[model samples]
Target chain A: MAKILDGKEVAAALKDELVAEVDRLRKQGITPGLCLVMAGSRPDSQSYINSAVKRCSSIGIDCRVKKLPEDVTQGDFLKIIDDLNTDPKINGIMVMRPLPQYISENTIKYKISPEKDVDCLNPINVSKVISGDDDGFAPCTPAAVIEILDYYGIKVEGKRTVVIGRSMVVGRPLAMMLLARNATVTICHTRTRNLAEETKKGEILIAAAGKAKMVTKDMVSNGAVVIDVGINFDESGKMCGDVDFDSVCPIASSITPVPGGVGAVTSTVLAKHVIEALKLQKGIY
Target chain B: MAKILDGKEVAAALKDELVAEVDRLRKQGITPGLCLVMAGSRPDSQSYINSAVKRCSSIGIDCRVKKLPEDVTQGDFLKIIDDLNTDPKINGIMVMRPLPQYISENTIKYKISPEKDVDCLNPINVSKVISGDDDGFAPCTPAAVIEILDYYGIKVEGKRTVVIGRSMVVGRPLAMMLLARNATVTICHTRTRNLAEETKKGEILIAAAGKAKMVTKDMVSNGAVVIDVGINFDESGKMCGDVDFDSVCPIASSITPVPGGVGAVTSTVLAKHVIEALKLQKGIY
Candidate 1:
């Protein structure tokens, strides 16, 4: 059976470090602050924000949520961003995804201050990630993957790593991160021909395709390290990942469970970004 | 024998299109203008700039070179960029790389306005390339590779493409471009183990490792399309590509030659960006 790479363990360890960092800053009369901006009352967004707020509070960081009306005009939405951009109290800012249809995503992405962009929505931060700038903030989800790998002592250098997705949020960014670590990285997507053939070649396989149980045991090689980034509900309503865990676990060397895997660590990564953003704002680094 | 993918042919075809575009803009009382900024007189940089100027002139676009001293201060260098940023006459700006030791390349990269960054040095442009934004400018070398593929009707979709090298200017950007087109892209570098094993799987192979004739017959699969992005002088001072042309040519289906391949098309791609920059400035698009 594959050894379980526990996300909770990794997140707890990270939280401990962040807690100390926050305490140090607080003693210096500085409290790291994060602001969550949401245009509409999306249940998903609300749930995510709630958890993020709780996470920040636990780490001794100040967290705020700005719940705007569903009918907020683009100009009004941008005005809020502008206010937060200059607000000394706010160290990091995260605007919830899938904003109201009327608001321009592009405008908001550009308007957010790069120094305060904890979620890395700003193109400047995104550019920094691509250019392998260590100082720039990476999106929370992708950063969580790297954190997990580091915690588990998985050496990425010279490894044949396969990422099965091409999203800006996860797959592509993760590939860039892995490449920076000297891994031979291959990116596969829905359009990939002979998917099984490609997946089997990876010493480290990452599935972020968002399809539950899409990766069967046949797709994975024995003793390969499998990282499932997918969060989906199987037909019976059980939370699952892209990999068919039951079958693949017996053959794989390691794997992360869906609920306790990447999902569990994402909010903590957000909290970590808040602290980094604070340091950037105060020139502490 | 593999068909020779002639770079001059592709460049000539692109030049024809650019010539017509420039003529149309000129008739509208607007001449597209590009400014080339160089810090010192590096012979290599001078040669590149000279060819670019000649190409721009041939395409009926105004090209100006700003030559600075070897010991130019960062403040003075940035002042020049600041002036060009607001200059109404210049629509596109390219700062020659390998600036003086006193100037920070990062500072210069960030200083150039995204609207005028024809060479895509600005991180904003790099971010756009990563995000698959079609509106943003791509680096000339990578864009030229895509242009050559398009000109030859070599479909990238669903192809297994391998890129050797991860430089921001070439491999990484080209991988992103290919991924955007639905191709599965694997990035291999110096740290990659079993390099030949990984490369042989690619139906489309790109060599950008800057090593002369590193790719041998055993490294490529039969009938694969090979593109050499290297511009190196072998021991005999003969210009060559990353591929061992004599050995691999018989088995490969198609290949791009060094002197007449990617090198021949890079300058033309720069000229295309000038037109694009002009259109963006005038809001013509």
Candidate 2:
């Protein structure tokens, strides 16, 4: 059986480091703060925010959620973001996505201050990510994957890393990050031909396609490090990742489980970004 | 022997399209204008500028070169850019890169207005490129590669495309563009292991590593479509691409030559971008 790349363990270690950093900032009378701006009461968004708030509290970071009405006008939504951008107390601002249909997503993304764009929604941050500049914040989920790799001491340099998605949030940014670390990165998606052949070539395979149990044993190479970034529900409504963990577990060198994997470490990564955001805002580093 | 992907043919075709478009805009008394900002008179920069000016004139574009002293201060350089940004007569602005060591390249890249960033130097344009949005212009060199492929009716969708290099101007953005068109894109660089192993898998191979004759016949697969984006002078001072053309040409189904391939189409791409910048600024389709 392959070794389980435990995300809970990685998150715990990261939280320990962040706790010390947060304590140092608190002693300096500077509390790292994060604000979650939501337009509506999306159940999924609410659950995500609740977990994020819980994680932030544990790390002693100030986390606040500003819930607006679903009918909030685009101007009002942007005004709220503008206010958050200038708020000294808020070092990081995360706008819950799939915002109202009427609201201009681009306007809100552009309105947020790049320094406080903890989720990296700003084009400036996105550009920095693409350019491999350390000044910008990468989205937490992808950063969490890196965190997991770092904690496990997996070398990315010169490795053939294949990412099975091209999302702005995960696959695309993650490919840039892996490439920045000197990995030869390939990005595959629904349009990719011979998906199995592509996945088999990866020494480090990342499944971010959001399809439950899409990756099977035949698709993965023997001894490949599989990082599953999918949060999908199987037919029985069981939370699962993109990889068919049971079949591939024995063939893989290491693999992360769905509930206990990337999803577990993501909130902690968000907390880490809040601290980084605070440092950037104050010019601490 | 492989069929040559003629760059002059692509350029001529593109020039015809742009000339018609430029004439239409000129009929409206709006001549698209471009400003080439250079800090010093580097011979290479001068040569590039001369060719750009000639191309712009051919396309009815008003191209101007702003030459500053070698020791131009950052403040003075920025001031010139600021002036050009608001100059209604100038629709596009391109700052010749490798600015004097004292001036911050980042600052200059950020200074150009996004609508007028014909070379896609601005982070906003880079972000748009990554996000697959059509609003921002891609750098002319990579854009030229696309123009050649489109002219030849080469299909990118579902193709296994490998890009050798991770340069901001060419390889990286080109991979994103290929990915945007639904190609399974892999980016390999100097740090990539088993380089031949990687290149052999590419149905479409793009060489932008800037090395003189690095890609050889053994590195390519039979019938692969090769796009050479390198412009290097060999030991004999003969202009050559990254590919060993004599060796790989026989093995490949189609290939682009360095001098008559990507380079020939680049200036035309710049002229096209100037027209695009004007249309964007004037809110014309």
Best model number under TM-score: 2
- What candidate 1 keeps of the native contacts, as a fraction, is 0.92
Cα deviation in Å at residue B122, candidate 1? Answer: 0.6
Ten-residue region with minimum lDDT total, candidate 1 chain B: B127-136
DockQ of 1: 0.91
The ten-residue window of minimal lDDT in model 2 chain A covers A100-109
Worst 10 residues of 1 chain A by lDDT: A127-136
- Candidate 1 lDDT over B111-205, as tens digits, reads 99999999889988998898899888999999999999999999999999999999998999999999999999999999999999999998999
Which parts of model 1 have CA positions greater than 4 angstroms off?
A: none
lDDT per residue as tens, model 1, A5-97: 999999999999999999999999999989999988988899899989998899998989999999999999999999999999999999999
Instruction: Residues B13-128, candidate 2: write the lDDT tens digits.
Output: 99999999999998998999999998877887888899999998899999889999999999999999999999999999999887888799899989999999999999999999
Please provide, for model 2 over A98-140, each residue's C-alpha lDDT reduced to its tens digit, 9 standing for 90 to 100.
Answer: 8988898888888999999999899999999999999899999
